[model samples]
Target: MQIFKKFSQLSIFYSEYVSFPYPHATTVKKAHKCTINHCLLHSHLVSSHASHKFVSSGGKPAGGEGDGAGAEMVGPQRPQFVLFGSSIVQLSYANGGWGAILSDVYARKADIVLRGYYGWNSRRAVQVLHQVFPKDAATQPSLVIVYFGGNDSMGPHSSGLGPHVPLPEYIEHMRSIAVHLQSLSDTTRVIFLSCPPVNEAKVREGVSGIFSELVRTNELCRQYSEACIELCQEVGVKVVDLWTAFQKRDDWLTACFTDGVHLSAEGSEIVVEEILKVLKGAEWEPSLHWKSMLTEFGDDSPYDLVAFDGKTTLNPSDWTFHRAIQWD
Candidate 1:
């Protein structure tokens, strides 16, 4: 009952923020709006521990239906999938951005478990995975989605340029992940999303010398995508080329991203739609119940909360506090 009350409060808070306009038109202003939205969403889920219930309740709500049913449902329940990677997945909570969209679209189709960290590199990600998901002989996921490598390529390398790890080394790190996931379960499908492109102009203008480094990083992303495809084929892992999808659709750039680095709510939706396409093509059965939940709860996506007011001054106080717990 407390959880339900908390959930109701969450719904109310999200509704308020979703309806509020950004106080300003600058990137920081928009980010502040998104940050408030995210904090509220995450507070609801994490504070009330609803996500844990969702994970451990055997595909049933805590006190929902099926209590009096004599016979178990005949059809298969929702499939459980895990998402592991970087800021993209982490950013989903604020606006249900891409992850929320994917969850809504695929909810009754698949139960997605998201494990993402902001500013995490492949090396750190690998460590996090081990800590979070100590592979068990019996408990393995049906699908694993990995979206990383952007930070690794843009780092504080001694040269202050190029990939933190060379292309070959990056490929090996990815390979290790794939192999480990496979070892967990024969049926576990792994889908690795390619990192999207950075805006050259934004980079050059925003951070001096970072633009050239980002260009090189984007190039590596291209190369890495190609290599990942080959590596997956060789090792029998599924791959989703988000970079190519972004390239084909200009709207992915114009609609989704606030800056070259991060995706707006609209942009995240595009990414989710593209990912759904891949899942459907693979004939994966997503969870309809979860999809319904998303549709019901995520109808007011961040895109709908766009600010049109012409305020120019960006105010930091409007956003929720963000202390980067870890970096690099």
Candidate 2:
């Protein structure tokens, strides 16, 4: 009852008031907002535990017996699918961010781990890969999606010259990442999302003052996108050519981008579609919908119980959510 109430409250909060801010906004501001939201969610989780009186396997009150002892088996652990990149990826959880869409589609199928940073380039990404994807199998992801190059393609003379990772170095960094990911798990698939084209005209026209003078142009972004495609090809990984995809559309500037850099909801939809295509090609499908387990009003039988920890039980009360329910 406590868990149900907690989820119900969260659901109401998100449906009524939650909204991720624009991606191109300052990182400090965005992060501050997210921090507040996280703190609230963490408090909710903690409070839920206090109210949840777990029943042990022997039908005894958990931690309510002698010595305040109790057994806790935090249910299942699902396959992890991680997204690693810069602000573009980081903003995916925003209203129109592709990452958010992916999270919705894969709600119970996989745990979507977001490792997106505000201004990270492939160089910075490479440095953090090991920390994000530890060698431990338990922590390693089943799928890794890498989206970078927006910051890497910035002109050397731009506001922060240090962010510009050279073309050759960019390509190499991508290659190294692919190799490292493959080494972690043979089954782990990697996909690279090439940078989308930037509209310099739009940026200069006072659309987004943040990147108005940033040295990133459509031409420069094209080069990085091509390099990403080539690197993926050479490494036998999948590549999504977002640059080409956006350019093929008319009025991409207004339709795809909120700012000159971050994607709008329309752009996010396109990204979600492209990623789904790749997933389909690999024969990936959504996990069984949770609703399937619900009994109808006239139903006389209970749903079969299954455990993610490789165990089977007839009691639905025994199921806990340690991990997510994954697609078969």
Candidate 3:
């Protein structure tokens, strides 16, 4: 039954991508360039793609026309790509864990920077944006990927977190970020990755009542992710549903997580795989063996034993567990 269900879903995904038109390669290339420009800008939120130079309206009038009326009007130019965020951008390097893998896969295919932090939240992300991207440089990125809300959902600040970042405030921040980028380049695309699920077991074992806190935190993260999607939609920004994709995989628990919070090497690979699928305009395909494995284990119960190459194995690490925290 599980095999049938898994195959059915894979069929649907394969069909969807196969039927849907692939985004133009040229367009994707252009978007990559734009993303680079935005990353270089750091925090100023200015558009690097702006072609027209703004002249001072206070200058003396030419002929009988007023100074403003005689001002030259510059036409729009081709769109560009931009990058934005926090330490995640830096994390794209080899030392940056999962981000490095993503960087290598997407390298040249798109211009992306991992502007994530070791421990940062939305507020901190905003601060980094302010510091890194200057007003003029902010506009070039055609595609912006946001991997945030994780740290925000945890830590001391968690108590003050809310369902939404106050609609008005959220809009204002998004507007400030988007308007500048749009002004620099009219066709920038912004994508926000929803926060992944927390390891409740780790919370139960490590900190008292923290597991419950994580549940509440995950819920809030979901809300924020939804809010971000809606906000992007309102302003014509593209959004990628990373949380849902991660949730669908069976290995997240065993292969990816190291301590129920951070991703292990294998776990990061799963994330990169999904990102690649999206960038390539592909869909998720659950392996037949993976589905069968899930059926054997059942939901909410850990796999006590694993089988490999015609032999039973006691070590869970031998198998590739999808979308769950690793025990070791």
Top model number, TM-score: 2
Q: What are the per-residue Cα lDDT tens digits for candidate 2 across 1-328?
A: 1111122233212221212121111111111222232233311111212222222233433334532243232235566778998998888898657887666565544667898899898898898878887778575677889998988998885455568999999999989888998889666778889999977776666535554455668788989999999888889988889998888889888889886778898898888777776776664333222222221121111232222222221232312221121111
Show model 2 residue runs off by greater than 4 Å: 1-75, 158-160, 205-213, 283-328
Q: Write the per-residue lDDT of candidate 3 for residues 1-328, one digit (tens) a residue.
A: 0000012211110111111111111111111122232132111111223111222233332343432343222223212223344333344454335565543333223334545565555565555564555556634554556665555445343666532244345445655665554554444445555566656676456657543443424565566567666776787655566567556778765555566656666656655565444444522222111111122211111122222222221222222222222211
TM-score of each: 0.59, 0.63, 0.48
Cα RMSD of predicted structure 2: 12.9
- Give the Å error, residue 196, model 2: 0.7
lDDT of 2 at 171: 93
Superposed Cα deviation of residue 165, candidate 3 (Å): 6.0
- Scored by lDDT, model 2 comes in at 0.64
Candidate 3 accuracy as lDDT: 0.43
RMSD of 1: 14.7
lDDT of 3 at 22: 15
The Cα local distance difference test for each model comes to: 0.55, 0.64, 0.43
Best by lDDT: 2
